[model samples]
Target: MEEELISKKELLELKGISYGTLYRWKRKQLIPDEWFIKRSVPSGQETFFPRDLILERVDSILNSKEETSLDDLAKVLYGSPVEMNITLNELVERKMISDAARSAAEPFITGPTDYYGALTVFSIGREIDSGDISLDDAGTMIRSMAAAEDREMLRQGVTRLYRKQGVTFCAIISDASKVSMDVSSKLVLEISMPRAAAAFKAKLLPNKGEEEDE
Candidate 1:
């Protein structure tokens, strides 16, 4: 079969890429290296199988949403598409994320998860501003609420709380996590968060012997 060939100038115009970027892709092995054939009797050099491959790579890059540089784009344009998919899946599995949470990380995400993991929710047991309710009054309120069987339901939560530089942090829990009950007085909300989240955000201590909850 006859291979179509294009000059470097023609290639750049067709691919809508600058010459330096194209050369950089070559240096990084992001694209298949071109062959240089030299004949002692004739011209300087020749590059074979050039244009079609470059075009194929450019098409792939244009279609992708990722903000890739020339070299990275060349890598994708030249490398197996499946490797990228597998790498992303591996990252998600390492984070201890389950299948359900993985699905919610949609089109914008390159990975299987959107960094959602379990969080440690602490109740300060008082309003942020003590002026709104005295500490003693807030304690009474909490005690009253905790005494009721439906403390969670009775409390009207922060719908439009005016605060300084704070917002809600959403997270997901592992399927393994559940309420552990014992003959004691506390309810243990066992959770499995990603290592990064558990370490930095969840405020949960490492694996330990937890007291059995009632």
Candidate 2:
């Protein structure tokens, strides 16, 4: 198949993205180096991009802005370690965590798991292993996440973990994270549900041809 190419000027105008932002994303490796295809044209040597890939990546970046940090979005878009998936057994077999950690993580899973869910479990295990949180506390965190109204809400949100002096606190707030939990405790685990359906939508899902259509 002939690879579709889009000019830098066209890309910026089409996506309403600024040149500075584009290069910055490039520097951060949010967009791959090879995607910046520099070639000589009638006007001059100009930068171009693999049409579909760049647009999809840009969409992912824009959609993730409020949902997560740019660094996290970069990881998700580039399939970084945090974005990789592992089964419950594999998580332990690979020594990413102990069997006890997996036991603590089981209560958080409401259904068949995905990469994001696995990452959450792995994170909980790491916190327990490092003594940042106790096994019971980890279970509390997992249960909190699992209590989200739906899988999508749990999958699409920010998890804030705060530590001050000897106290540790964690909260998961998604567009669709609404739920009830004990907040008076030092460990606060609750989901702030989305007020509207649009708020709960997942941005990372592929928006194929969205830019092209524009």
Candidate 3:
């Protein structure tokens, strides 16, 4: 990767804060101090950083400023020199507006679905209810996913979850779905378990008759 550096002047312009405040923040160690290397410049010496590093440092301020004191903001945003989840909760507990209006002191958290990453498959099984004629028509099909091919099939399966039929809710318990080998690339056993159904199902059944798949 390439380095991202910014001169002291550049940082000031980007921050739009006065030199006095900058020096004050420096004294407080809100940013890199010793790391702020000085280099030769036309006007003698100038402090700078690789632009990316500067941006990274700025991002360290997980908690943004609003009306709170700088100390409070840093403490809430960056936690202590030692981090604990509770420290981040302080700003929010005080109801300081760091993000939006209502989300003033909230944590900036995201989830797995919030990001796109490699998905993991635990186990593959079908939901076997004495209903759904399709179950009897085809003994069971199985497709195991441990590679890119499996993920793609999973995507298709998840997409069809709302519209398709292979992964249907079973009447066995409060929460369970019927699954089959028809939509998997895994073991070809039509065993139904508690519903935490897979995203999609692929048809590779041994039945001689062609059954239109979802």
For candidate 2, write residues 1-214 as lDDT tens digits.
5699999999999989998998888777678676788999998899988886778778877876775666755654542433333467765765655787889987666454665566566556656776777777788677766565555544446555544455656677663236454555443332322211111122223322232264
Clash count in backbone of candidate 3: 28
lDDT of 3 by residue, 50-69 (tens): 67545544544322444446
Q: Model 2: which ten-residue window has the lowest total lDDT?
A: 193-202
lDDT of 1 by residue, 68-175 (tens): 464544433333221212222443344423333233222223433211211111121113232443333333333332233432222212211112233212112223
Best by TM-score: 2
Regarding TM-score, does 2 or 3 come out ahead? 2
Q: What is the lDDT of residue 50 in candidate 3?
A: 61
TM-score ranking, high to low: 2, 3, 1
Per-model C-alpha lDDT, please? Answer: 0.34, 0.61, 0.34
Q: Which stretches of candidate 2 lie over 4 Å from their true place?
A: 83-214
The stretch of ten residues in a row with the least summed lDDT in candidate 1 is: 203-212
RMSD of each: 23.5, 14.7, 22.1
